[model samples]
Target: MKVKGYPMLASLLAVMLLVGLQTPAYGENATTRATWIWQTDLIKDGGEELLHFASDEGITLIYLQIDRQLPPEIYEAFIKRAHENQIAVHALGGDPRWALTEHREDMLGLADWVLNYNGKVSTGARFDGIHLDIEPYVLAQWEDETDEVISTWEQNLIMFLNQASGSDLELGIDIPFWFDRYTLGNGTSLNEWLIGTFDQVTVMAYRNQVESENGILDLTRDELELANRLGKQILIGVNTKEMPREPHTTFYGYGKESLNAKMEHLSSALGSYASFAGIAIHDIRNWQNMSSDVTVPPDEEEPTTPPPDPDPDPNPEPGEGDRVPDADPITRDPVVRGTYIWEAHEVIRNSQEILDFAKEKNLNWLYVRLDLEQPYTKYSSFVKQAAAAGIEVHALGGHPIWALEENRPRMMRLVNYVKNYNRAVEGDERFHGIHLDIEPYVLPAWRENSQQVISEWTANLDAFVTELKKDSNLEASMDMAVWLDKYKVTGQDMSLSKWMINRMDHVSLMAFRDKAEGSNGIIAVAKEEIAFADELGKPIKISVEIKASHEGDHITFYEEGAAYMEEELAKLPELLKDSPSFTGSLVHAYAYWKNAKP
Candidate 1:
C-alpha cells in the first residue's frame, strides 16, 4: 500500500474504468433546460443576442429553426458558438400541413437540411439533434374527417421516425400535452407511441401555473411516466408571449420572480421521478425577457412514474370559500364599480354633476370618448377634477372597421394622439388607458364570412398591438362579448374569445343582462369570462346596460330602477369573492343612467 507509484496507478485505472462504463443519465434531476429560437433570429446579427439570452437563462439545449437559405458558414458559426458555451443545438422546422403526402418530400427536406449541415460543419459545430414541430390538429380535415386525418398523420409520423432512426442524428418532436387523450389504430396512446418512437419528446404544457388539473404538471404527468418506462427523456414547455386577456396561459404575466418560484415547484413535484428532465421555456426571446435563475437539484433514486393523483380530493370536507388554488394567491381589492360616460360635450359641460354622481355611487373608473376639438385647457380641467374625485378615466372610441387592415393606421393615429396628449398632460389629467370598442362580429362581412373576417380582424389587432407596443406602453383594453368562446377559428382551432383575450392587456365583457339573479342573468352570462380572467390573473370589468336597447328586456337595465342596479351590483363581491380578478362592475352610460326614469 505504501509502494512508490502503486496507489497513483491504481487510481488512474479506476478513473478510466469509471469513465468508460458511465452512460448518460436519463433520470430524475438529470434535466436539460431547452428553448426554441425562430430561424430569422438565428441567421441575423440578433443571433448573438439569442445566444447571450440562452446563456443567461441557463439553457442547455436550443431547438433552433432550420433555415435552408442561410449560408452554411452562418449555421456553423452559431453551432460552434453554442457548443463553446456547452449548449447543444437542434435544427428545428415543420408544418402540420406537411403531414400530407404532397408535403412528405418537404418534411423529409428538413432532415436532409440537417444532414447536409452536419456534414458541412466541423465536429464542434455540428447539430446534436433535430426537432420537428408539425402540429396536424389545425388542419381542416382533422375536424371534418378525423379518422382519415389521423391515419395520414400516423403514416407521416412513421415515415419521419423511420428516416430519423435510419440516420445518425438524434430526433425530438414537440407534442401537445393532450396527446394522451388520442389513441392510435394499434390501441396505444399517441403520447405513449411518441415516447416509444423518438429519441425525445417535448410536451407543450404551456400554462404558467404548475399546479391544478390542467396546469403543466398534471398535463405532463402521464407523458413523464411513459417516457421513463420507455427509457427516454421529455421536456415540459411553458409559454411566455403576452396574452390578449387573462386565464393567462403564459409566464409573461408571472414575471421573473414568480416564474422562478413556479419552476422550483415544478421541480419539487417531478424531480424525484426517473426521466423527469427540466423545464423548457417556449422561445428564446421570451425566456430572455423572463430572466430566471435555473438551478438543478441533486438527483434521487426513484421509480419513473408519477405518484398516484395526490388523493383526488385533497380536502374531503368543504370549508367556507375554500377551493384548491389554480395558482399562487395574488390578492387584489374588489373593484366592481364604474360607468360609461357618453356624449363628450355633455361630460365637459356637466363635469361637476358627473363627478358628484360617481362619488355618490362610489364609482372608481369612467369610460368616455375624448373630443379633441374642445379646448385642451377645458378637457384637462375636467380630467383633473375627475382624478381629484378618485375616478380614473379611460378613453373609449373604436369602430369594427378599425380592426381591418385598411383602417388600422387611422386607429393607430388615434392611439398615438392619446399617448402624445398624455405625455404633455399631468399624470392625473391624462387617460389611464385606451379602450378599443372594435366589435368585429357587428360588421356585415363578419355575418357572411365569420371565419375569414374574424381571422383578418385578429391579425389586424395583433399588428396594431405590435405597432402600439413599439411606441406606447399605455394600458390598452378591448370590448368583448361573452359568447365569443363558442366559435372556433379555422387555422388556430382556439375560440375567438381566447384569441382576443390573449391579445389585450385586459377585456371589458359585455355581460349586458337586465336581471342580476336567475340562470339567464348578469352573473350567469359573465361567469365563464370571469373564471377565465381569474385563471389568467387578468382583471375583468363587467359592464351592465342602463341605456335603452333595441334588443329586449333581458339585455338592458333600462326599466330596472337605479336602486335595483345598486342592489344587484352589491351582490357581486360575495358572488365573486373566489375570483382573483373580479375587478368590478361598470354601468353602460352616464347620460342614459342619469336620466333613466323609475
Candidate 2:
C-alpha cells in the first residue's frame, strides 16, 4: 500500500519551511477565509446563490460534504462555478464508526470515491482535497472501551493516510482544540502528531471570543504552535450555530458583524505563526442565518437571549460541556421479500416478464447473477425496469475457488465489473449491491485441510468486502449456510456464521427447510443466526429452496404448492415478531418458483 511518490515527513516539512515566510497560498491567497457546506444538496438547485454568497463574503475555501447519491454532474457544475469565484472545494465526509477498524472500508471508500471522481471530472470541477471529520469520542464505547477505540482510531487513520498517499489531493482532518490533552502510547500529543501528519489541520476552536480562559485563541494555541513547528497549514474554526448547553461556544447571538470582528481579531493574534492558514466558519447555513442585529456584545460571557432550535451538527463530538442532541433511532423495513435469479443473460430480453413476476410475488429484492462478459447495457434496462417496480437488483456471482488467496483476482473481477458498471450508469439502473454465493466447503481443500481452507476463506472474504466497499456504496453480502454457526473461525472466538453476520450488511441464511416451525425446521435452524444478527443490529434474510433438491424432500418447497409455501411463510412474521433482524424471506430462485405448482 506504499504510495510510489509519497513525500517523507521531513522532506515535506523542509518544503513547507521554504515557503513558510510568505502567506499560505490557498485559493485566492487573501488570508484563507473559508467555510463548510454541510448540506451539499443545496447545490442541486442553489449553486449560484451559494457562489454569490461566497463571493460577497470573500470566502476562499469550502469544505463540501460528499453525497455519493447526488449525481456527479451536480458537483461538477457547482465546483466549476465555485472555481470561477476563486473558491477551493474539498470533499468532506466521515463518521464516528469510521474510526474503528471494522469500518476502515467506509473511510477508505471516501478517499477512493474522491480519487475516482476527480479523475473523471474536468480540472475546474475536481475537488481540491479530502477532509475527514471523524470523532470517535462520541461513541458510548469511548467511555468504557477507551483503549480499544483509541487503538482502532489510530489504526484506521494510518490506513487512510496510506491509501491517500501519492494522490494529488491534499489530505486534512478536523481535531478538537483539546486533542493536545490526549497522548499516544509513545507519549506524543495527538494534536502534535496530527499536525505533522496531515497536509492541513483544522482545529475546532468553537468559541465566540478570540481571547479569554479557554477562548478560541487559548484553545487553539497549542495546535497552531505545533503546526508552525511541523510547517503545516492550520485553519482555526468557529461556530455560529446556537449551543444551548455551552452558550459561550457559538456566535449565534453575536451576529455576523460580531463574528467577523472576532475572526479578524483571532487572525491578528495568530497571524504571526507561519502555519496559521486562516479562519474557517463552522458552516454556511448558520453563518448566513446569523442575525445582523448583533444582540450580544463580542466580549459577553453568555448569550443575551435564549437559544433557538438547534441546527444539524456537522462536527458532532459530545464531550463534558459540548453535548450534542441524540438523533432519532432508525427503523428497519417490516419485511423485505426477495428472490434469486441465476440466468442474467435473459434480463434484457425478458425485462418486462421479470418485473411482472417480481411485482406479482411482491419481491422487493433480487439477487441477479452477473455475467461479467456481458455488456453493462444488457443489465441496465432490466435493472432500471425492476427498480420502477420497487425491486432492488443485486449483482450475484461466486465460485468455490474465490475463497482462496490465489483466486482473489477472480473475486475482484466481479467487484470491479459491478463497480465500473454502476459508475457508467445512472440511479436505479446500477446494481444495488453484490451478493456472493461462494461455498468453500464444497471444495476438496475443505476436507484436505479444514483449518487452512477456513483461514484462506476468511482472509479472502475480508479482502473482498473491503475492496468492494473502497469506492462505492454497494452493500457487501453473502449466502451463509444455517449450520455455519457450528464451525468456529480459525482463531476467532465467534462462529463463522457470527463472523459473516457481523461483517456483511445483511446475510441470506439458507435455512432451506419447507416448514416454518418445528425442531429442525426453517425457524429453528435460523434462530441462532437471527439472534446474532439482532445483537449486531444487522439484518438476516431467511432463504427457502423452491428448486427441486436431490439432497432431501424436507429441504425443498417444490413438493408443496406455492399456496402451501405461502401458508407456512405467513407464520414467520408472527412467530419471529420480536426479532428485529428477521427481514422477511427469500425463495432459493426465480426459475423454479416461476413454474412451481399453484
Error of 1 at 43 (Å): 3.9
The digit string of per-residue lDDT tens for model 1 on 1-598 reads 0113345433433443343234355445555889888645445663677788778768899888877887878888888888988899898888888777778888888887787777776899898999989888766456456667667776776666555553556678999988788887767777876766666788888765566556777778888877666666677888875332222356653357667677778877887656666778877665565434321111122111212211211112223332224444445577748887656666777888888889887888887776654456667887898889888888776755555555676577667777777788888788888787766553435555778877777877787667667656777787888777766655865556655655677788888887777777777877766765665567777788886665677778777767887788788788877887777788887766776644
TM agreement with the true structure for every prediction: 0.52, 0.49
For model 2, the superposed segments whose C-alpha errors exceed 4 Å read 1-30, 300-598
Tell how far residue 541 is off in model 1, in angstroms.
Answer: 16
Encode model 2's per-residue lDDT on 248-308: one tens digit a residue.
5677555678888887777777757767888889889878877675555555343322222
Best by TM-score: 1
Where is model 1 poorest over a 10-residue stretch in terms of lDDT? 295-304
Deviation in Å, model 1, residue 530 alpha carbon:
20
List residue ranges in candidate 1 displaced over 4 A.
1-28, 291-477, 480-598
Scored by lDDT, model 1 comes in at 0.69
